[model samples]
Each structure stands twice: as C-alpha cells, then as structure tokens.
Target chain A: MTSPLVTVTDLKVHFPIKKGILAKTVGHVYAVDGISFDIMPGETIGIVGESGCGKTTAGMAMVQLTPVTSGAVLWKGRDMAEMTRSELRALRREMQLIFQDPYSSLNPRMTVRQILSDPMDVHGLFTGHQRKERIDFLLDTVGLSPGQADLYPHEFSGGQRQRIGIARALALDPCLIIGDEPVSALDVSIQAQIINLLKRLKRDFNLSLIIISHDLAVVEYICDRIIVMYLGKIVEAADYASLYKNPRHPYTRTLMSAIPVPDPARRTRRIILKGDVPSPISPPDGCRFHTRCPDRMEICHKQEPAMRRFGNRHTAACHLYTDEQAEPVENKPKAKEKIS
Target chain B: MDQKTQASILSIQNLKTHFFSRKGVARAVDGVSFDLIPGQVLGIVGESGCGKSVTAQSVMGLVPNPPGKVVGGKIFFHHRDLLTLTVQELRKIRGAGIAMIFQEPMTSLNPVYTIGNQISEMFRLHKKLGKKQALAAAIDMLERVQIPSPHKRVHEYPHQLSGGMRQRAMIAMAMSCNPEILIADEPTTALDVTVQAQILDLMHRLKEEFSTAIQLITHDLGVIAEMADQVVVMYAGQVVEQARTVELFQHTLHPYTRGLLASIPVLGHRTLGKDEDLVEIKGMIPSLYDLPAGCRFSNRCPKVMDMCKNHLPDLIDMGGGHQVRCWLHTREMIS
Candidate 1:
C-alpha cells in the first residue's frame, strides 16, 4: 500500500482554565485528550463530533495551527513539532486550512484578487507577470469570472465567497486541505454547490482532504473514512459504509439516529441522549460518554474500552464486544423503546 | 366575511410586511397567507432573505417600526386583529396568549439578571403570583424543561449556563405561562445535532403536555419533516407550496421545493452515484427590493416557460388542502 500522506499518533491538546487576577492556571481542560488517526494520499477523511468534542482542535493540531501539547504528527515521515519557524512556514504551503463562516473568514477590505494573491505573495511562489495570471486562473477554477476579481468580498454572496475561500486554499497547489465546518454557514442549496466543488477539485488535483464538521450527513457524502468523536476521544472509526450500515459503539449508533431524516416516511425512533455533554474541564471518568450512553455496562464507568476491530478497518471502543470471542453484536436484539 | 376557522389558533391573511430603506421598499413578507390549527405544528421553510422570520414577527407584532412596517393584510389571533391592537393591549397578550422563542438564547436573555429573576417576571406578570411564589414557580418551570439541578441553576446568569442550557431556559420562560401559541424561529439552528435532538424532544414533550400550537420556522427540511404536521415552502417572500407533511414529501410539486429536497444529502439514505452532481438551485435568492414580476423563482427555475416569465401563477388549491404556486400545478397556466 502507498504510504499515508499524514499520520497523527497519540495527539493531546490541553488548554489551562485560568482564574482570578493573578491568572494562575487552576486546571487544564482536556480538549483533545488522546486521539490518533491517519489520512491516506488522495483520500478524504472526516472527523465528526459535536461542540467541545475537539474535532476542530484535532484538525488544527495536525496542520500545526493549534499548539499540540504532546504527540507526534508526522508529515511524510518528518515530525512537525521538530521543524523550525521557516520550515513550519514551508509546511503550511503543503497543508492549507479552509474556515467556516464565509462572512467573517474573508476580509471585507480585500478584493477577490488580493485575497487569492496574499498567500502566493507570502510564499513567494510566482513573480510579476505570472502572479497576475495565476490569480485569474484560481478565480476561474472556482467558477468565478475574471472580471469579478476587482470586487470586494462584500459584493459576493455566501456561496460565491466560499468559492473564493476554496480558491485561496488552492493558491499554493497544496497536497492537503483541511476544512473546519466549511459549508455550515451557507444555505442548503449553496452548501451542495460547495460540496460538489470540493469533490471535483480533490479529484482533479489528487489532494488529501480532512473535513471537520458537526454535520454528519455532509461529511458522510464526501468522506470515504469517518472518525466519530465524543467529548475528547474517538469512539469509533470505520469505512463510510460500515460506520453507517453497522455502527458498533453505542454513542456512534445514537449519533447516527439523532439526525432528523428529511423524508417523513422514514421517521425512526430517535434515542435522545439523557444529558448535556459534560464539560471538557471535568469530563466523566473511564469512558467520556458513559454518563449519557444508553448501553452503559458496569465496566464502562470503571474502565475505558479498548478499540476492538471488526471486519476490515471497522473499529469501535465499546465493551459490548470482545476480540473474536463474542458473536456478531447484531444477533441479540432488544425491544425498541420510544421515549415520549 | 372575515370568518375565522373555529379550529385555527392563529390566522394570517394576505400579510404584507415591507422595509422602507434609503434604496427602496423591500417586500419582505408580500402577500403571504397561512393558518395554524390549534395544537398543530406549522413549519415555514426557506433560505435567508426568504422572509420566514419576518412573517413570524408580523404575527407577534414585534416588527421594529421607523423602517419596517406591516404595509397591508390582517393578523387575526382567534377573533382579534393583532395589527390594530395598541402597545399596552398587545403587551397584555404578548407572553400570556402568544409567546416567542428566538434562535439565539444568549443574545435574547438579559445578561445582568439571573435566570430565575427573568422567568419569575413572567409568572408575576401573567399569573399574578407573589414575589416568593413567582421565584418558586420559576424553578418549577426549569424542572419542566428538563434542566438539571433547577434550584442552583435558577440563580445563575445567562453566561454561566451552557448553550443547550440557555436554550432550555428560553423554552421554560416561553412555556411558563402556558401560552396558546409558541412561535420558535430556527429554534435549534445554532445547536449541535445531539443537542438539537435533545431540544426537539423537550419541545415535543412540552407541546403534548400543554397542547400549544407551534409556528416553527427553519431552513433544515430534516427538522421540518420530523416535527411539522404542516409544511409551507417559501421563496422570495411568497409561499410556493403548502401541504400536509407526508403529502408534501411524497408528492413534492414546486420546482423550488424539489430542488431543495434534492440538494441536501440525507442521512440513512442511499448515497448518490460517484459521477453525479448534487441538484443545486442555480442563482441566488432575488433581493427583496427587486423581485420578478412573474413567479419569483422563475429566473432560476429549471422548468420555466414563457408564461412563467411574464405572469405570476396564483397559489391554486388542488383539494385535500394542498396548495401550489407554479405553472405546472396551476390550471391558469397559459402555454
């Protein structure tokens, strides 16, 4: 098999909670606790979670945007943490970030051409005559006309501005693009346009993509592999079909069912989790999701479950199944309970 | 002959709300009509600039004046016209007869006051409870909405609570007086899906317990399909289609609705083929100040005809309470 484009091992990001005038660090909020995953070349991997789950933080840490407290993020066999300032800047060109909120992400004062060229200028890639041509080409690739390059971000709609955002990410011809809730700020129809654009660009440029979103369906559409997060841990990781078709972890199963189906005919019984996600600063013991998990056993509250692998790459961290000893977990069925 | 439907709790007829700015008039809610049956959920779905929120504001008489005004039409709450009510009279019915829950709870709730202090005011105003009694009832209200440790949470301000908790507090205040109607505009849009599920479940339970009619407005069809008994599809400040929830999904008529349904990637459904592109509605929503003389959606409509370009199709009723405004559905279509 071809070597993975990026590999993140045992990553942990902790933010200290400060109190009082002295600004003493009282306790650390376990933002990303410990998570590990990898992105293959030309593959689209999605990190799915709710707010405070550290999905965004995990993505940022991989690209060296957020400070990684401890862990190794190896980019093409080189550890990113060991890189110098100039070397880190060079690494940024290979991995660019696309942000959410098209309204706030783009600078109001900058024109489309300026936004696209700023990255190129910083990187010192193209010069003079060729730089102007590259800007025009980037805008055209994103489906905007060359004439609209002079217009400021305020003149464009949400969808068009997102396209401009994508063009800026593509300015350096990066090998990877990490989008954190990229299309969540746009309308449904506009979201579709952007999703399709990203798919096309990925295929054309052979780029590895990491999309971090709270939206499961949007991620399900574009990503071939998915990692489900709860609090600050990866509860499950599987190929697209296996995760949705046969989810192993209870949290993953509940999350899959929680989303409201668009078609009225397919209204399934939604298993609403009991309480709010516990604060990351003081997350629950053992399994972070044990406090709210419906299928919590006695062991779940005392000891964290190991990631047990099923067929192929489908793995889930749950005590329900043991390695090869237990029968297929789907055989024993329980009566469906609907909460009114 | 302004006869009210006996079962309808809220009735809006030919409602027209406009914004008079320096540029020109923006017909935000032009010629919209809908009725909310008692205890039923009526969902209004559309993109931004489609005026779903403005329509809700018109019913509550909360539209800011000076620039925004109810230019025309009547808002009847059971037999009284809300548009004609004075500020004092409207305030009397505001939280008691009809209540509203905004999208952003943090912004809507006052920062300085404690949650208990804010909710107790509703009890004192509407139920005429004593100060101590009102505070007790506020805690009870918090319990009803399923907020954990209601007693301690009551003393906390808005910022102290989490996003999901703040939203529950908002819901509690709205339901404290047991209003006949609850208008929630994009209630769970800002929330995560898991929290969204929790809020939706709470709303369902409260609705069943109080039997309160809900006017739910959201852009997500998933939420609309799951909760709304009746669905009204809006485009460019006009209702393009209205039908019962199941009927609308099974037999989607309007091109805009079809485009919207097809565009969103649904969960638990078959994924699209690798080569296929998502069915996107072309072009942007028209600016309210300059809408088309014809069907407002005609400019981007995939099945537009010559007649659809010049003459607007009326919202024609096609029996069984299904109404559609498109040349394909209307007999008034001149081919």
Candidate 2:
C-alpha cells in the first residue's frame, strides 16, 4: 500500500453516560474500542456490523465529526488528532460524510443550491458566481437536473434527496467519502440506483470510499475489502472474495448465513445466533461474541483473541484460528437444518 | 402445496384499497388478489410504495377510514366476506380470528403499559378471561415466545426491553388470542441480523405449533424465500406474479420479478460478476395516483411490447397454478 490515504491506529471512542439530579458521570458506552484499519487511495472499504456495534461511531470518529477519547487517525501520514483548528478546517475540505437517512440528514428549509454551495462557502473555496456554477456541475454529476437545484429537499423523492446528499458530499471535491448505511433507508428499487451512482462517482473521481452498512450483500457488491465489527471491535477483515468464500469468525459466519438468499432453492442452512448483541455499556467479558457464538470454547469466555492473519490480507479474531496451546476445534460444516 | 388442494384460509378477490388524500387518490392496493392457505406462510413481496403493507392493513381492517377506504372487491375470511362486515363485527374477529404484528416494535407497544398488561388485554377482551387468569395466560404466552425470564419480563415496561425482546413480547400478545391468521408486516425489519434470525425462527416454530396461517409482508426477497410457501410479487399495487416459492425462483416469468432479483447483490457465487453493473429497473415505480394505461411495469420493462404500452394485461394462469401478469406471457398463452 503506497502511502495509504488514511490510517486509524488502535482508536477508542467512549461516550460518558450522565445520570439524574447532579448529572453525575456514570459508566461509559464503549462505542469504538481499540479498532485499527487503513484506507488506501481510491480503494472502497466496507465496515459492516449490526446495530450498536459502533460502526457509525468509528466512521464519525475517523472524520473528526465525533470526539475521540484516545489513539490517532492519520490523514496522509499526519496525525489528525494533533492538528490545530486551521489545519483541521483545511483537512475537512478533502474528507466528507454522508448519512443513512437523506430525509433527516438534509435541511428541509435549504434549497438544493444552498445545500451544495454552503459546504464550499464554509471552506472559502468558491464564491457567488463560481459557487453557483459548481453547484450546477454537482447536480448534473449526481444525475439531477440543474433546474431542480432551486427546489427544497421536500420537493424531491427519497431517491433524489439521497442524490442531493451525495452532491453535497462531492461539493468540496473530497478525496474520501464515508457513507453510513447510505442505501439502507431507500426502497429496494431506488437503492440500486443510488448504489450505482455512488460506484460511478467513486470511479470518476478516483475517490476512497468507506461504506458502513449492516446489509452484507450490499457491502459485498461494492466494497473491495470488508471489515466485520462485533461489539465495538473488528472481528474479521478480508477482501470480498476471501471473506465470502471462507469466513472464519463464528459471528461473521452466523451473519453470512442469516442473510436471506433471494433464491429459495439455493438457501443454505442458517446458523441462527441465539441472542441479541450484549449491551455495549457493559459488554460481555473476554470475547464479546462468546455468549452468542455456537462454537465457543472455554478460553473465549476467559481471554480475548487477537486478530490473526490468514490467506492474503484476511484476518479474524477468534480463538479457533489463533495459534494457541488450546486444542482447536476442527472447523467443519454443520448438518443441514431445514428452515421450515 | 397445491393451491386447489389446500383449503383457502383467507381469500382476497380483486381488493382495491385506495387512499383519498388531498393530493390525489393513491391506489395503494389496486385490484390485488391472493389466497392464504391454512398453516401456510404467504409472502407479499414488493418495494416500498408497491402496497405490500397497505394490502396487509386492508386485510386486517386497520386502514384509516377518512383518507383510506376499501373502495372495491371482496375479502373472504373463513368463507365470510370481511369487506361487508360492520366495524363492531370486525372488532370481534381482529384479535381472536386474525392478528397483526407491525415492523416497529417500539411504536406497536405502548411505552406507558407493562408487557403483562398489554398481553393480558388481548385475553381479557377476546377470551373473556379475568385479571388473574389473563395475567397468568400472558406470562404463559411470553414463555412460549421464548422471552427469557417471563415472570420478571412480564412486569417490565416496553422501554426496558431490547428491540428483539420487545418484538418477542409483541408476538406473545399477538399469539395470546391464538388467532387463525397472523399478519406480520415486516416484523423483523427493525432488528439486527442475529435478532432477525431469532424472531424469524420463533415465527416459524409458532406456525408449526399453532398451525396459524402467516401473511408475511416484506421487501426482502431473502425473507420471502426462507419463510414463504407461496409468493405474490406486487408492482404498483398489483399482483405481477404469483407462484409456489420454488417454481417462482426457478422459472421467474415476470420481467419485473427478474429485475428485482437481479438488483440485489447476492452473497457467495451468483449472477453478478466483477466490473458488471447491477441490472437496475430503468425508471422509478409508476405513481399510483396516475398509473400508466397498460402494464404498471411497462414504463421500465426491458421486454416491453407495443400492446404492453396500450393495454393492461390480466393475470394469466400458467401450468401448475403459476400466474403471470404481462403482455408477453398473456400473448404466449393466447398463442
């Protein structure tokens, strides 16, 4: 990786819980606890996890939208945490974030013209006439008509609003774009359109994209590599082909199996996980997934496993895969259980 | 599971549920028709504005009146025409004969009331059970739905419970009356994958244990494939394709169905390859307020013919009870 665009080193973000009356500091919600990854230039990396897994927190923390408790996020080999106000402001122009729900993320009062130009205005990039021209270019780039720029977000449909959101993200000519569940809120038919638009934009701009979504299929389709997070930690990180072919982590396996295959006849026996994700406030001791993992060993409840590397660029955090003294359970295909 | 052999538990005949808003008349469920078999899961699959949820609401008699109305057609439940029934008569059948479970567990459950009170209300109203008996029955129902520590959980409010547990409690309340049909409208859509799997498994087990006909409505094809015995593919509030689950997947007749299946990025080795764009349906779903004259999907249909643009096609019954509504298929039938 020739000087990665961004590198996150052992990042941890803990949100403090405040109680009644005195507003006393209670326990902390370990949102993005000790996670690390790198984004190479123009590469699309996907971060996937269910609700409360801290994928969103990690994405926001990377962009400096959320305050980080500890560790460093290096933007082009420079520590972003240490950057001064002026430096951080300059960096913001090259990095951007797109939210899941376009309806809520976008301001209803602002017209599409204002929404796209305001970001550039904040950065002091283009002014007045130049900004207007730039906004038109952006609208056209996102497949929306230049005339529609005068209308408010309410005037457009869910799909068009998302396009507007995308146009706003692209306004500053950002090198990196973080889409947190970007297409999840959109309808099935419209989702594909937005996804295709994202893919095309990424290619056209040579942009480094970080797509965070719970939908495995969506991630697999677009992302060159995927990072699977479980309880504020990355359980597995692998390239698309390797991850889909041989997923090592029990949680990842369960998640992959849980996805409803469109074709009924090709349905695989689902490894139905037993329970919900343990509360993030006080996550399970040792391995966070031990309580739900079917193939759990004694060590999983006592010690957290390190993320070990496998076939080229593939890594998984599971005792089963780690080179440890404990007898490893032979990974075998489970008996086919009928869904009906 | 032959359609003719299995007795139709609930039959919908050309049901037209239209919403009369100030803007225009949105034909949410325009001439949609399907039959649910006893103890069988019938999946209604469509994207958001395609009227899958409205169809479920129409069946439950829960569609809001002033703006909404079942303008035309018949809904036969146990050979009784539900459309003709009065509000009071429909109320009797709601919890006891047919139950409904919504997508958002939080909204469906009352935040102020305890789980026990909510569940017991069903038994009290439908089964005529007293407070003591109703509470006991509610706890039993909670246990049946596999909500851990039913005794403690029953006393807890909805806010105290997690997303999965809240849905489980909702299911418990739905099953408290032991209704003949359960209309689960995107029941697990709001939960996590693991939680979704658990809820789906619970629904499957309950169907087997109680022999309750389930009308599962969702946009997820994967959910439809796993749970449905039969599927009705709707487009613009109309049944585009209806067939047995296996047959539907194997021989997908409708172009719209094919497009939907292709649009989704499948896991493992599948159709889409590297560097290939997903086959998207060209345009947006036709506006229900003013649908195209011919086929609802004709505007975006790849194999659209001249007749498709001019005249609407009827649902033509192919062999083995597989029906497809398209000019191409109907033309083939005519030939």
Candidate 3:
C-alpha cells in the first residue's frame, strides 16, 4: 500500500495572550492541543468542530500559513518545521488552502486571471504566453468561462468568486487541498455548486483533502474519514461508515444529534449540550468534552481517557470503552458508574 | 387550518418595498404576503437577495426610506393599517407591539452602553419604569435568556460578553417589552451550532410560555423545520411556496423549494447508502433590479417550459393551507 500523503502527529498550536502596555505573555490559548491524524492519497478527511475549536489553525499550520507552536507535520516523509527556505517554498506547491470567506479572500483589485496567475508567477511555473493559456485552462476547469478572466472579483457573484478561489488552489496542481469552511459563506444553492465542484476536482486531480468545517452534513457528503474535535482535542476519529453509524464518543453523538436535519416529522431527539465550550486558554482537566458530555463518568473529571480502539481504523478518546474488541453495543456502561 | 384572517396577530397583504438606486427601482420585496398566527412561528426561508429580511424590515417599519419605501401593501396590526401610521404612532407600537432581534448582536447592541443599560431602555420606554426597577427587570430578562450570572453580566459592556452571551443579551432586550409579535430575522445565523440550538430552544420556550407569535426569517431550512409552524419559501422577492411545516416538507411543490431542499446535504444521509453528488441549482440569483421577464427561478428550473419564460406564475393555493407559485403547479390549480 502507498504511504499516506500527509501525517500530522501531536500538532499543537498555542497562541499567547498578551496583557496591557507591557505586552507581556500571561498565558497561552491552546488552539490545537496535541491532535494527530493522517490523510491518505486521494482520500478526503473531514475535521468537524464548532467555532474557536482550532480546526482552522490546524489547517493553517499544515500549509505553513500560521507558525506552528509545536509538533510535527510530515510532508512527503520530510518534517515541515525543519525544511529549508527552498524546501518550504516547494512544499507550498504540494499543499494549498482554500479559505472560508470568498468575498474577502480574493483581492478586490486583481482580475480573475491575475488571481489565478499569481501562484504560478510566484513558483516560476510558466512564462507570458504559456501562463495565460494555463490560466484559461484553470478557469475552465473550475467551470468558469475564459472570457470572464479580464473581469475583477467585484464583477463576479459569490459562487463564481469561490470558483476563482478553487482555480487558484489548483494553479500548482497540488496533491492536497485544505478547505476551511469553503462553502459556509455562500447560499444553500451556491453551496451545492461549490461542493460538487470540489468533489469533481478531487476525483479528476486525485487530490487528498482536509475539509475543516463546523458543518458535519457537508463534511460527511465528501469525506472518507472523520474527526470530531472539542476544546482543541480530538474526541473521536474513525472511518466515515463507523463514525456516522456508531459514534462511540458522547461528544460525537451529541454533535450528530445536534445537527438540524431537514426532515420535520423525523426531528431527532436533540442532545443540546448545556453551556458553551469552555475557554481554550485553560481547557477543563481530564476529558475535554466532560463539561458538556451527558454520560460523563467520575474518572472523566480526573483522568484523560486514552484512545480506545473499538473497530478497524476507529478510535475514540472516551472513558466509556474498556476492551479493544468490544462492540460497544450498549452506550450505557452498567458495570461502571455513569454520571448522567 | 383555514383560520379567520381577523384572528392573526399580524397580517400582511401584498407588501411591496422598493429601493430607488442609481441603477433603477430595485424591488426588494415584491407583493409578499404572510400572516403570523397567534403564538405560532411563521418562517420565511430564502437565499440572499430573496427579500426575506426586507419583508421583516417592512413589518418593523425599520426600512430606511430616503432610497427605500413601502410603496404598496397593507400591514394590519390591531385593526390599524401600519403603513398609514405616522412615525410617532409607529414608534409607539414598535417596541411594545412588535420587537425585533437581528443576526449580528454586536452591531445591534450599543457598544458604549452596558448590557443592563441597553435592556433597561426597553423597560423604561415601554413600561415607564424608573431606573432602579428597569435595571432589576433587565437582569431578570437576562436570566430568562439563560445567560448565567445575570448580576455581573448586566453591568458589563457588549465587548466584554462572548458572542453567545451578547446574542442572549439581544434576546433579553427584545423580550423585555413582552411584545405581541417578535420578528427575529436570521437571529441564530451568526452563532455556532450548539449556541444556535440553545437560542432556538430559548425562543421555543419563550413562545410557549408567553403565547407570543413569531415571524422567524432565515435561510436555513433546518431551523425552519425545527421552529416554524407555517413555512413560506421565498425566491427573488416573492413567496414561491407556503405551507404547514409538515405539508411543505412532505409535498414540497415549488421547483425552487425542491431545489433548495435537495441542495443541502442531510447528515447521516449516506449511512443507508444512497451516495451521489449533491443536486445543484445551476446559476445565481438574478439581480432584483433587472430580473427575468417572468419567474425569477425560470433560468434554473429543471422542468422549465417555454411559457414560464414570459409569464409570471400566481401564488396558487393547493388547499390544506399549502400554496405554491410555479407554472408547473398552475395546471394542478386549474384542475
């Protein structure tokens, strides 16, 4: 089997909180506190969480857009942190990030052709005539007409602007595309068009994608693997099938139940977690999710749960499970005290 | 479900709001009509530029009128035509009769004022309460919206509060007056999923407890599913489909409504193994100032007929309180 395209091991991105005049570092906000995952070639991995959960920071760190506080991001068997300036520049071509807000992400002053051509110019991919031809091809690949290349970003609609963003990400033909809430800023109908475009691009380009979004529904639509994050930590990680069907961790289950399904008659019994996600600067001890977890145990308050493997390629950092091969058929553990 | 029109807490008929811009007359809200039944949630779901929020603004008399005007339509509340009311008369009914909460709490709440000071203003203006009593009422309102530590939070400025807390504070101010009808326009759109759930839950509890009617306008169908009793699907300044929540979900007559529903990827949808690419409504929303000759959604309709291109479809009633505005459904109405 081929090795994974990207591997992120124990990645932690902590931002310092500075106080008044002195600008002294008082404490650090644990944005991506020790999260590990892998993206196989041509596989789409979804990192799902709420706002301020650090999914965006994690994505930025992987692409070197944000300075990583600590931990390792292996890019094609080379450590991203240790790479030289030239090596880092080359690594940029292998990983591209599609930002959330299409309106602000693209420079208003630039034309669609300029937006698509800048990356190629930066990387020295092609010259004058060849670059223009490539720009036309890129715009066409993203379902926009080549004639519209002369128009500025303000002339296009939100969906068209997003297509331009996608074309920019694909300018270098990167193997991995990390989209941070790619379609969150668009309307439902426009969101559909963009999602379909991303899916088609993935298949055609054979690109591995890390979709960081608060929306699980959209994530599940195109992902092969899923990770549920809470308070800057992964509560559950599994293959798409197991994660959706089983959802071993209480946090994952809460998140699944919380999603507002389109059906009216079939509204699921919502597990509305009490209170907001605690401040990430000083996350709750033990399990990060225990504060909102309904089935939290006494042990959950004092000890952080290890990753318990229940299914093939499925693991959850929950305190409920014991045996490695146990099916976890019953969610409630009768043997141990379950603090409801 | 055919109730008396006289019983509706708020009734809107053929409301048309136009904006006079450099380009031309932008028909933001074109002949839109809906009613907020007593203690029920009336949802207006639509894409951007569909006039959902504009419809809400027209009801609250909040439309900025140098370039905007409610040129037509009658909004009848308490047997009075709100359109005919003077600015002074409208202000009398604004907070006490109908209160509104916006999507962005930071912009809505005054930055310089304390949370209690802002909320207390509602009590002072509507109830004519003294400063001390109004301050106490503000804290009570904060508690009602589930904001923990109301005592301390009431004194803090809007910036000191988190996003979720600030939203709850906005709700507290809206609820302070105890209005007959609450018009919430995209109230939970800016919030996170968990916070959104909490806010929606608060609205539901408040509705049940106070029996206040709600005109809930949103782009999210899921929120509409969970909250709305009557659903009105809007497209480019007109109601495309209106029905009881269950009927709208079950039958979904309009092509635009069907396209909107199909576009959203429902969670756990593929667990039963019906995997396929998302069904997209091709093309963008037409510019309101220069819309198509007929149906706004004509360019994107999958079952577009030649007749749909030049003729506007009527909002035809399909009985059982379900209404659809589409050429495809016009035949069924004729039958």
Q: C-alpha displacement of A203 in model 3, angstroms?
A: 0.7
Query: Runs in model 3 with CA error above 4 Å?
Result: A323-340, B1-3
**Candidate 1, A79-143: lDDT as tens digits:** 99999999999889999989998889999999988898899989999879998899889989988
> How do the candidates rank by TM-score, highest first?
3, 1, 2
**DockQ, per-model, please?**
0.74, 0.64, 0.81
| DockQ of the two-chain complex in candidate 1 | 0.74
Ranking by lDDT: 1, 2, 3
**Which 10-residue span in candidate 2 chain A carries the lowest summed lDDT?**
A331-340
Interface RMSD to the true structure, each candidate: 1.2, 1.7, 0.9
The predicted structure with the larger DockQ, 1 or 3, is: 3
lDDT, candidate 3, A143-176, per-residue tens: 9999999999999999999999999999998999
In candidate 2, stretches whose alpha carbon ends up further than 4 angstroms from where it belongs are A324-340, B1-6, B269-275
Query: For candidate 2, lDDT tens digit of each residue in A214-245?
Result: 98888888889999999899999999888988
lDDT of 3 by residue, B1-335 (tens): 23645878788999999999999999999999888889999999999999999998998888998799999998989879899999999998988899899999999999999999999999998899999999999999998988988999999999998888888998889888888999999999998888888888889999987788999999999999999999999999999999999999999888889999999998887666875888899899999888999888999999899988999999988888788889888886568
Return the lDDT, model 1, position B315. Answer: 94
Q: What is the lDDT of candidate 3?
A: 0.89
**Greater-TM-score candidate between 1 and 3:** 3
Worst 10 residues of 1 chain B by lDDT: B267-276
